[model samples]
Target: MPMQQRMEMWFQAWNSLMQDMERQGARVWPLIIDPPALLDEIEAREKSLGISFPPTIRKILQEGSRQVQINWSLPSRALDPFSLSGDLGWSLDAFEWPYFGVDEECEDDKRYLSFHVGGNGDMLLIDLSTDAEDPPVYSWGHETGEFLLLGKSFTEFVERVTELGCIGAESWNYEALACEDGLDVEGQVAQEWKEWLQAFRTLTLDEAVQDFEKLVVFAKMHGAEDERIQAAFAQYDWEQVLHVWVKHIEQETTSSNLLPWCQLIVKTVGKKAESWVLSLWESEHCERLGSSLRAYVTAVCLPEEEGLQRVIAEMDEVVARKECLLGYAANSHLHHFRAREVILWMEPHVAYPIEGWDDLFAVSRPQWLDLIRWLDGNEAQRQIALSAWGKMLANGESPAGEADWQEIHRLLDVAYEKAILRKEKERVDRIRSALETTMY
Candidate 1:
């Protein structure tokens, strides 16, 4: 498939996730980008830097589309996969890469091409040596002052990194990377979407409710996961899907279909589904759970702030008893992430261990970090999370829990970089130096 199609599939996946996250009042992603630099512009950048870009990098720069860039909404996938977008193609020397290591023979300007970067300063780089067709990608670890192999070649990097983006897997998945197998992620995600598209294409409006679960099983066998439900819904007509989905849910509402169906209405159908969803919620069939109630959003549909306020109060009442983040709320918050009170509400709670903490720190840790990010947390907040996750990594089971630590490492890097931006340079230096000390 074309790269554009691959991206469209990715946009389909993320758009739904963005909506759900937005419903929680999170700031949408902050990484804005422009179109790829033109070939002449690429050469101009190379001329200014006094070195030739690696062959693969040059090809990408040349091949990349100069079309209008994707807006905040991801309105277009017209560009090439390798977005040298925005202030990209900037050198690593700016971030002090030379301070870590240097060649006696080579000048600082002729060193590396920074192709990809995390929000933190961690970058995936291409060594600009000999203008090879495909150079090995490397990351200069600020904590260790070492250059680590990220990928053996730019092609491999694209395959592996595209998979990471698709599955939201950890970067530098060592096990997969070790044998030089890149999980063929783009193909997998794209194929899964194709299967969903075909399944829905075959689907008839008069489809019997009894066969609904069978259809879901069929889709799963063809590579459907619950997380992709919204992406799947994005492909087909909502009213048509709703027509079939309601019939299926009418038969059995227990599984992933309920949330996806509810999401379809709240997201796509908006106000059209409002009175209907409300009536459905009150009926014996809808089961007035937190998930059911919090779907109201003023932006998409559900402008009835009075109704949403009622939902919030009920959610507060449940949490008042349990004290756990999930506590009695059980996957429901008042959907107040955007509300003015959320930061003040979330701040005091972060310091508390709460009434029912457990080994399943899974949900709480990320939740806390997200809240802190939105709260504009300081160095102290980053320190608390880093210190805690360090212990968690140490106590965690070997090999199996390794991915968790990798994720935490990535998140902490982001948190620390945020501090660096906040003029907590001293704090960030200490944090990196402390991590450096751990290497010894």
Candidate 2:
């Protein structure tokens, strides 16, 4: 397909896709910035970079050089429904530099022309080695400084991106475009994407619940991810969603498959969800489920006097446990039920993170780090313990004592060191930059 035709088709789809995001409560609007790029500037960049722009790229600039956008950095045609799109090459000057273009240790000496710059410092580059009319696209990770093929060609990358926008996918959810094994063009990713669009239509509450369940079973059979199914239940009543998840919890020995649902339940507690929560709390069955309920959801489902006590008690138990790997998230994980007020209420009762906390002193895989990689095993109790400490200081309030202040320093220091070793530059920089705020 010609670049002009391909972009025209995508622009039309962009209008519809923005409507989908609006229905989901996005405060965003699309803009058509016509003649987004200047021909002279494009030619200048090509010459300065010592390479010719791909034919597809040159045609796309003529169609819409830079102007289509929901905001300054994102393109209107291929905007992610949930996050900002990478900036298209428009004289950002960041694109002028190449990854390891100077390092002698770098084995791959292929020159790359970065056409799309990611918000997270990653980039989509056109490989200039053995040039074809339209070259292959590769992604450079900001974290590991590694390159991975994104699409066999720029046209394929364009199609895959627009398809994702149409499906209301988030920015980083690019599994369908994975190019390592091979582009799974007609495979499960493509098939499920079609099915998701079909299943995304407006349905009665009962129909949506039933459809969600069917998708769950189907996804498990194919080893699919859970974000699609979670999005389904999140739109409906907590009572209905929590009830279905509880049923699944009772049926399955491992509550691992239902972590997202449990996380939702934790986020959505109210009078409408009271009776079922109480019933589950009283039930002897699903002792595993009991742990989650007893931990934090109790603070919202029950009376303040009773709920806060249980929350404190649960955290106490976890803190005392040997090598505990995740606890105390109630403070940051709030809902509309005045959860923040309740969290502050427990500030006196609940134990704030400290250097002496069991996991902090552990020889390996402390709770702070373990929670970062929680989905690896057990599948159950995959709650984020890091939030309790990482976000505790960021909640727009001064600490009650010096303990939490010092713990903030500890959490930031520990996380930064780990992030550096893990080669996660984004995380390392974020944590390292905040280390000063933690310093007394």
Measured by TM-score, the strongest candidate is 2
Model 2 C-alpha lDDT per residue in residues 171-256, reported as the tens digit of each score: 24354446573234456766665454433322223443466665443322222223544455456666666676566656755434
RMSD of every candidate to native, in Å, equals 18.7, 12.8
Locate the minimum summed-lDDT window of 10 residues in model 2. 375-384
TM-score (C-alpha, index-matched) for candidate 2: 0.55
Off by over 4 Å in 2: 26-36, 67-95, 105-110, 166-172, 180-183, 197-242, 248-293, 303-305, 312-440
Summarize candidate 1's per-residue lDDT along 189-299 as a digit string, tens digits: 444543443343244323422354544433322222333443544555556655654564466434443444444445434565555555544657345333543343322
- The TM-score measured for candidate 1 stands at 0.32
